[model samples]
Structure formats: structure tokens, C-alpha cells
Target: MKQVIIIGAGPAGLTAAHELLSRAKDMFAVTILEESAEIGGISRTVRWHGNRMDIGGHRFFSKEDRVNRWWAQRMPPQGAPAYDDKALGRECSLTAGGPDPEKEDRVMLTRRRVSRIYYNRRFFDYPITMKPQTFRNLGLAATAKAGCSYLASCAHKLPETNLENFYINRFGRTLYGMFFEGYTEKLWGRHPRDISADWGSQRVKGLSVSAVLKDMLKKAAGKKQEADETSLIEQFQYPKFGPGQLWEEAAKEIENMGGVIRKNCSVKKVHTEQGRVTSVTVQTESGTEELRGDYFLSSMPLKDLVCGMNDVPSSVAEIAAGLPYRDFVTVGLLVKKLNLKNETKIRTLSGLVPDCWIYIQDTGVRLGRLQIFNNWSPYMVAKPADTVWIGLEYFCTEGDSFWNMTDRQCTDFATQELLRMGILTSASDVLDTHRERVKKAYPAYFDTYAQIDQLTAYLDQFENLFCIGRNGQHRYNNMDHSMMTAFLAADNLLAGKNDKAAIWNVNTEKTYQEEKNESGEGGAI
Candidate 1:
């Protein structure tokens, strides 16, 4: 009998398998079942036209130094062969008197353009960068109106209980409307007030009005740019290929340690008896195989996990069904030619938009965030001038047009939007287009998220069954956080500890003190 049965091939599952076997040194058997054909879950990168493009935009920023070093050590013994850092030149060219035009294009395919918030038929500088730019966008008359609104917002700036109140307290009505309202509303398919404020608090921290004003003042003078320098807080790490490469490599490591990763093997049913997991029936190419295991670690979606369980109480099943998720559809377009503009050289578009991911605040535009894959890694796509992949991320419900649209329809829509926005000249520039619809990609944090406590209580009845991962725990965690949860779970199992709820709550702190020491440099890699 396999010692452990891991129910997903994502980073969390792979990490769990690795840590389990590595710590024990072949003390137990482990197996992973993945519904998809490949590893990495949403982090998986698909090969399109000989180029690798991610499911969406994935950045490698992490607060943990060990996570950073783990990646550095795992990547191919040698880093990607040195390309002449031409993209770096283009990034520098974004500033005045930076790189020469000929040298910049020789290094990069395109230059990064300024990203603005489009709202109420006007574009505004996001993060409220410069007072002059903000005033220009809002106009003198509107600025006065915003000032009056800001005072009213200040009077009501109590501790926020919901997402809407949080934003209203932080940025006031006008700024929040122009910058956050539409895109956020579209992302969750719910009002900002209906969603919990915890999501907002965690995602955006340390950026206050005073901080932005200070950064803008610093930029206006000849002083060093605080925006670029302090934005990331510290360094980040990425795989040579793309974000998916990390999971693929981790999968290889797990297999190397004698653990089996069964791809395209879907879990049909999870049989339980007396609140303990009994056996898991998987559907492979052959047929259904009931694999009995002493322990089960499921990284699959929480709703699907509960649905797959046999003979569960109907009330518990209904509660699991009540947990909602927001889906995402990404349209990846490969464009021909690199330099669409003459002046600036675009390397990566991290802050080009609102966040690293641009928010489409305009109601008229169908796309949400636009991620330039070439910015993450030039090697992400096949060739430079000939083919460059741009990811148009649109969030929607399962029934939304973006989700229900045919692949061809999405690709056409993306192409048309690129032309409409003047990002591309015509359809002739588009070499190839692809669209991927991800169902239940994000756990929607509604006002009723507290109801998850009831669902978690039901799962707690199971002695040997554990659910760990982003969707597994129904927590919006990043890659390292998810992997760390799995690692902690395996440790608990090995230690014969039953407290698993604590594992789900990892990465809860903002500006974690444990991740770094008093000295600003990394603690340990």
C-alpha cells in the first residue's frame, strides 16, 4: 500500500511529495495523481507555436529567502545562456536619456509604454503618482469635486469591515472609482463591498498616499527613483523557461526519488468510513482502480474534493457546493515585429499598468489585465521580432461571455482590442492566437467566507485525510505559501500530530517579521 496518496500535480503536491521522501529518505511510499496531462496545475506553461507561454502572468517575488535559494539550486546547473542584456537596455530606455534606439531594439522586441487607468472617458495615473498628472486627468473642476469627496471619505474612514469600505477609507471615492472599482468588480463578479477586506489588505500594503506623494517628489527631482527601487521590497526568482518550469522540475525530482506521478489520472471517488479516508478510486486509461491508502493529501479543489467523496452527508456536501470560485480566461496573442513604438524600449510591463497586472477600469474594454510574457522572460516565447506572446487576462464567471466564448472568438476579441488600443497595427501583425479558459481559478472571498468554517469543521472529522494547497484549503495563497503548507502537513504526519488547521493559516501575516531579520538583507537562503 502506498504510504501517501497526493491528489494533485501542482506545486503544493509535488513539494509535499519531495519533502516527505527527502526527509525520511525512502521511509515511505508516495504517489501523485494529476487530472491534467502535465504537471504544475495553473502554473503550467503550454507550448504554442514552439514557444512556451504561461496560463497567465506569473511573477516569482517571494519574501522567503529559502524559497529563492531552492529555485536557484534547482534550475539547470547553468543559468540560461547569457543574451546581451538588450531587454535590460530597453527597460532603462523608458527613462529619459537612457539607451540609444538602435541598441535598444537590437536587444528587445518592443519598448514598454506608460499604462494609465481608463475611467469615465479619461485616463489617470494609477497609484496617484503625480499631483499634476492626477489633476490633469481629473481636470481642475473635477479635482475640486474630488477634494470635497475626499473630506467626506475621511470623515467616514473607520476600520473597514468590507472591501468597499477599505478602499473608500484608503483612496476616497473618486480615486478608488477611477483606479479600482471597475476592474475589481469584474474580477470577482461582485461588488467590492460584498467581498471581504482581508483580500485587499494582504494584496496591497505599505502603499499610502503619503508614500506615493513622496515617491513622486523624489522622481521629479534628480534623485534616484523610489518607485522602481522600492516597489518589489527585495529580489525575486524565476525559472529559466517560465513559472511552469519550476513545477516541472519539482515533478522530475519527485519521480527521481521513486515516487510515481500519474498524469491524466482523475480521482473518481474518495471512499471513507467512520470519518477516516479509506480508499481513493482513480480513473486512468485502463479503468477505475481503487487504491487503498493509510493517508490522503488532496490538493484538488475543495468543492470537487467533497463532491468526489462517497457517502458524505448531504448537508456537508451542500455546504461544500456553496463555496464559490471566480474563473479566469486568458487570451495569448503572438505578434510579429517587436518595436511598435520609436522612442521607448519595452522590456517587461510589471508596473506599466495599475499593478504588475494592469486593471481594465474602462467599462468599454473587454480585457482586464494585459501581461507581456516577453517581459517576464525573453525566452518565454520562441523568437523575438517574429513572434512575441502577450497575455490578455479577462476574469469572469463560468457563464460570462469570456468564459463561454469559443477559442476563436476570444482570440479575435483580443486581437481587435489590441488594435483598438493601438497596441497593434492590424490583424496582419498577429501571427497566432490562443485562449485558455480556467474554471474556478480563484476562490471568491465574499461576505459569507466565514461559512467556510462550517465546511472545514466537517472535513476535520476525517482522521487521515488532509487537504492542502490553494484550492485545497480554499485560501488565496501564492506558490511558496501553498508548498509550505504541504511541507508542514507532511511534517505533522511524520510527527504523528493531528493539528492540521494551523497549516492552512500559513502566510497570513503582512510584512512577516520571521521572513527577515532586523537588518534588511535576507536572513538565510
Candidate 2:
């Protein structure tokens, strides 16, 4: 049997293990080495006192049927039960209260996406809809200025070089300055002009000022678009407890399928002979051990992977070290439901704007975004009726002051910022607080990002080594996109061929065609 070594048990690594073990159990010996004790990397949910918090919100929706089917096989939808829960000593009931007690293990909840931009102490539709309330809030003067700038942008037609130009080309200067400037700067710690246009293209590719206006016009006329745009998807599925449940179940299935998984095993070095990887050295509680493998897959950060190599080239090492990342902090504040209702002047706790999250576009505070965990799912909070949990996200560099702040200081700062933004009336409203800091949360796309192409090309020379996933590829891919890359890599391994080009071609838009070979294995085209 051919031995396979997988690094990092995130969505990509787990997906690769599942695919390989399911397809060729007798032919391949799969072993997964995960550095962290948990299954999910950034996608894992943190549980505290019967409350679950998604580090960042993960919406399970993908145009790829394969990805959807993979998730469905593990966590089925509510109505269509995948297994007989009664066999597991619980009844399955499809009711308004939620799935039956037994079905809770595999059931997924469908939630409508509701996000708004909180700017200038007012909430506006996230897609920038042309509504009376939006116009009234902006006032005539600012509205006219935005309109004139948009018209001038159309007339001048500036070339889109950087993020600033990309937004101006689409939404014009006035709107970009008001909506995109501060938020982008705060998120990346750089001016929009200094950031690469690739970030804008990957993030806000479909939506534009004209598109929103046209959609609003079509809505008024009671018309619908023929194509289903993924960007404008209104609803998505999520696990009952949190996204971590999906991967945890997947890890169990892999182990049951005769695949070995070693948690808390940190990879120290990847030993390569000539142009192919031969084995990997990992540090565990018992000390270091070397595992030999015919094929190796890495989902660790590209920089670390390059530096961890036995004898990497100086040029490659320099380029890898130059790649930057943006760190993140989420300060979860548990507040009294009654206090929040009174401050917002809403009739009931449920009356508060049903937004899963809100973008903090206001320049008064350092907060980049706010997530309403209760709105995400009632199960996210311990007591739905008595309390609400809000996540205040702040983006900063690893050693920056914001990231260096102690947990108490971060909680205190977030609480003060919430009051300043009028989310709460007083400090006494806070019941409890939890802070989570994530390093290298986002792969930075700056002017120096062009060096990535050289680095990728150099790394591709290794025949048996595959680098796939967000941080592995040094690309800011969403969860599904990362899975797609892994899927392609697994297909290559099963087919006994290397298809690095096709694996790298999986773009941010998730628009890649697949074809089956003579052996009936899926391969990306």
C-alpha cells in the first residue's frame, strides 16, 4: 500500500483524507497530522458554558454539487434524514422547535443572510440598495455628490490598477471614500491605494453600483434574474452546533475507515530527496518521530512550509518570508437581552435587526465588524431568552498594539467601543466577555504579492509534494474553494498522476470545470 501523509486537519486536509480513504481504502494508507487538538483550524467553533462561537461565520453554500454532497453525507438537511436516529436511541421529529433529539447530531439549519452597513450612526442595506430610507439618511447633498462622482467616473474611465482605483471605477470616488476607505484601511492597515486590485476583484467581483440599482429597478417591476449569482445568495446552511461539528464528524469517519489521525502533532521538517518529498518529522508529546510517505499534502502556511524544508533555496526562502498576513481578534461580549432591547428601543429581544452580522463602516470606532451570535443561531447562546452574545472583530498585525492587548484590555476596549457606537447604553449591561485571537487570519495582498508567483513556481518543482488550501497556496480562498483544491489533489493522488496546474487554477470565483478520466476519477480542467 502507498503511504500518504497529510498536514493540518482543516477543511482541506480532512477533505483529502476522507476522499482518499473512501475511494481507495485498500490501496492507500492515509495518516493525518494535526498541530492543534481540534479538527477545524479557523473554522472550528469554540464552546463555553453551553454556548458556541464560530471564530468567524462560515456559511455552507457552494455551487459545486460535490462539496454540497460531501457535507450532506455527514450532516444532512433537516427534512431529509440521512440515517435512522431511532437506531441510536432517540426519535427523529421534524418540527418548528428544531430537529428531533437524535437527529440533532447530523441536522443542519438553513438561515437567511441579513447583513447591513452601520455608517454614520445609521444602518443601510448592505448591497447599497436605492431605497427611500437610504436616501433620507444620506441627505440630498451627499447623495448629489455621489451621483456626480459616479457620472464623472464613467466619463473619465480610469484604469483599475489598485484597490482604490478598482472601487472608484465601479462605485466612484465619493461612495468609495464613504464606504470602502476606512474599513479597508482598518482591515489591512494600509491605504486602499497601496493594496492590490486582486483583493477587490476576488472579494467584490459581482456587485457594483449599477448592478444594485438595476436589481432594485427589476424588483420594483417584479422581475427576477435568470442566473443565480452566488454573491447574492440570500440563504445558506449551517451545522446545528457550529461548523466544527462537521469536521469533527469527518475526522471520526476517517478513523473508522482505517485512517490514522494524530492530534497535537506539529510538523517540524519535511525531508525531500532530490525533487520529491520522502518523509516528515513531527514533534509530539512523546518527542519527535519521522514518518515516511510516498505522497505528502500540506495545508500549513506556505511561509512555514518553505522555511521548514531541509535545504530550501535562499531566493525561495526570501520570497516566502516576504509574504504577509493580517491577524484578527474577536471580543465576544455577553449582554443582558433586556438591556439590549431597551437601548435599541425594540419591542422584544427578537425585534432587534435580524442581521447575522453588521459591517462597522463608522469611522468613530476601531471595530471592523460585529456579529450577532443569537441571530446566527439561537443555539449559539446558552440562554436564548435571557442573554445575547455579540462578537466585535478587530483586524490588526500580529505584534501591533491591538493584537498585543491583554484579554481584559481587549474586552474593556470592545465594551467601550460598543457603547460609543450606541449598541449598549451602559457598561453594567455586559454580563460576561470572551476574547479569541487568531494569528494570520488573512493572507495579505499587497503590492509585493507579485512575488507569490515566483514562489509557487519554485515549490511546484517537487513531484510528490502538494500544497493546497488558503494559507498553503497563500491565497485568500473561502472554505468551499479550499475544499475544491483538496478534492483535486486527492483525485490526482488516486489517479497516480500530478495535476498541479489544474489544482492551482481553482480561482476565487469557484468557476472551474471538471472532467472524469477513463478510471472514472474527477479531475479539474
TM-scores vs. true structure, each candidate = 0.82, 0.90
Q: Model 2 segments beyond 4 Å from truth?
A: 79-103, 221-228, 338-349, 508-525
Worst 10 residues of 2 by lDDT: 516-525
Judged by lDDT against the true structure, how good is candidate 1? 0.67
Q: Candidate 2 residues 408-503, lDDT tens each?
A: 999999999988878888899898989988878788788447788888888888988898888889877778878988999999998888759988
Backbone clash pairs for candidate 2 read none
User: Which stretches of candidate 1 lie above 4 Å from their native place?
Assistant: 76-128, 131-138, 142-148, 205-207, 210-235, 337-357, 510-525
Q: Which pairs of residues clash in candidate 1, taking residues 3 or more apart in a chain or in different chains?
A: 109-338, 111-345, 111-346, 112-346
What overall lDDT goes with each candidate model?
Answer: 0.67, 0.77
The window of 10 residues in a row where model 1 has the poorest summed lDDT is 516-525
> On residues 399-450, what C-alpha lDDT tens digit does candidate 1 reach at each position?
9666788889889988887677666777998888888777777876773465
The candidate maximizing lDDT is 2
